[model samples]
Target: MLNIVLYEPEIPANTGNIGRTCVATNTRLHLIEPLGFRLDEKSLKRAGMDYWKDLNVQTYIDYNDFLERNPGAKIYMATTKAQKVYTEVEYEPDCYIMFGKESAGIPEEILVHHKDTCVRIPMMGEIRSLNLGNSVAVVLYEALRQNEFAGMNLEGHLHELNWE
Candidate 1:
């Protein structure tokens, strides 16, 4: 399964939607702290997030905390400054794909160390970037697609309904 890492995400709804995506893909969601919102039951209810409980989520105190816990993780950083396209890389099934904050993106301090692993989603010249949630889906789905959508159902069935 792929792991999606959000470094200091600032939006609650984005996280909630990412949590839902994690659930749907059977992926893990890792959140580094200085988070913008709480994860308490009341907060989840306020966000109308029902499947959060089903999400395989983890929280880290900071970047070092996350590195200490998941040592040797095959991490790929997503950023606009990257030369490599997301699809060009061969993602391991257990690789960790990280996205930076909505405003600044992963600090150059961190990305500097992982230059070879940095990737970008191609976009028009006028656009600054895609939505955080959409960006995650784009990169993540590429990883998942590379993995042949493993352990996921490829087909959908219609519910039973008849009209005269």
Candidate 2:
């Protein structure tokens, strides 16, 4: 099971979108506090729609609290400052992929210590970063793909017709 952590997320809509993605992918969503918007914000509910209730989500007081609760967890910090591309690492089944707030992103203090696990998505000239929700999807999907999408359905069929 993969985990998606949003560190100090400021945008309600982005959090909602991330929540929906997490549900679809059977991943857990963790939110680190100092949030800019309330969890009950209308925009979040609207973006998440009916999926919000089913989301496997949790809240943490801070980074320290998260680390204490999830000991020995292999976490991959997603940041533009990372030296390696996100695809370079061979993600494990239970790895945690954390994205920073839309504004400043994860503090350099944290990234400095976790240099080995830091990763970034490739971007073209002048673009500072990708949208928070989009970035999560990009990295999460890659990890899922590498794991052969375990325990996930790989095909679909029409209700009234057969492939034969």
Candidate 3:
């Protein structure tokens, strides 16, 4: 299973949408402390729809706490400072794909320490970054695609059709 780590997310809707994505992809969600909005916010619930309850979410006191818990885990930090494109890295199963907050992004210390594992989404425009939820979807889907979408339903459609 892949892990999607949100470092001090500032927006409820983004986290909520990311939660839905995690649930859909069968990945785990790890949230760092100092969240900007409450988890029970209406905007979040609305964005996540009914899948919020099914999301596998874990909260950490801080980045160090997260590192302590998942010792030796392969982590890929998504940042604009990284030189490597996100798709260039070969994602391994159980690898953690971490994203920073809406405003500041991942801490400099962590990025510096794990510089080799840092990756970024290439953008042609003048924008510095993409939406948090969209970025998660983009990277997570790429990882899943590389892994052959192991646990996902690849068949025609999710629901069976009865055309009589």
Candidate 4:
């Protein structure tokens, strides 16, 4: 399973939606401390619907705490400052993909220390960044695709109907 790390995520809806994605993709979610909103917020529950409970989620007091628990784990930080594109690296199973908060991205110290593991999505438009949920989906799906969609269902749910 892949690990999705949200470092101080600000928005409830984004986290909730990401939780849903994790549950659907059989991925693990790790949240760093000082969250912007409460985990039980209505917005979060609404966005996640009933799938939030199924998500394999964990929380850390801080970056150091996370590091202490998962020592030697391959962590790829998603940041705009990275020179390498997300797809440039070969993603391995159980690798941790981390995204920062909406207002501020990952800390400079962490980025500098793990410079080789930092990556970014290519943005062609004038927009500064993509939505948190969208960004996660983009990178996570690419990783899943690279792994040939392991542990995921490929067939359409309504295939028996033959709608086409």
Say which candidate scores most in lDDT: 2
Tens-digit lDDT track for model 2 on 1-164? 99999999999999999999998999999999988899999999888888999999999999999999999999999999999999999999999999999998999999998999999999999899999999999999999999999999899986887769
lDDT of 4 at 82: 97
Q: Pick the candidate with the highest TM-score.
A: 2
Residue clash pairs of candidate 4: none
Instruction: Name model 4 segments beyond 4 Å from true.
Output: 157-164
Q: Rank the candidates by lDDT, best first.
A: 2, 3, 4, 1
Per-residue lDDT, model 4, residue 38, is 88
Question: Model 3 misses residue 111 by how many Å?
Answer: 0.3
lDDT of each: 0.91, 0.95, 0.95, 0.93
- Residue-level lDDT tens digits of model 3 in 20-79: 999999999999998998888999899999999999999999999999999999999999
lDDT of 2: 0.95
Residue range with the least summed lDDT across 10 consecutive positions in model 2: 154-163
RMSD of each: 1.7, 2.4, 2.3, 2.0
Residue-level lDDT of model 4, residues 1-164, one tens digit each, is 99999999999999999999999999999999899998989999888889998989999999999999999999999999999999999899889999999998899988998899899999987777899999999999999999999978998765457558
Q: Report the lDDT of model 2 for residue 4.
A: 96
* Better model by TM-score: candidate 3 vs candidate 4: 4
Please provide TM-scores, in order, for all candidate models, with all chains considered together: 0.93, 0.95, 0.94, 0.94
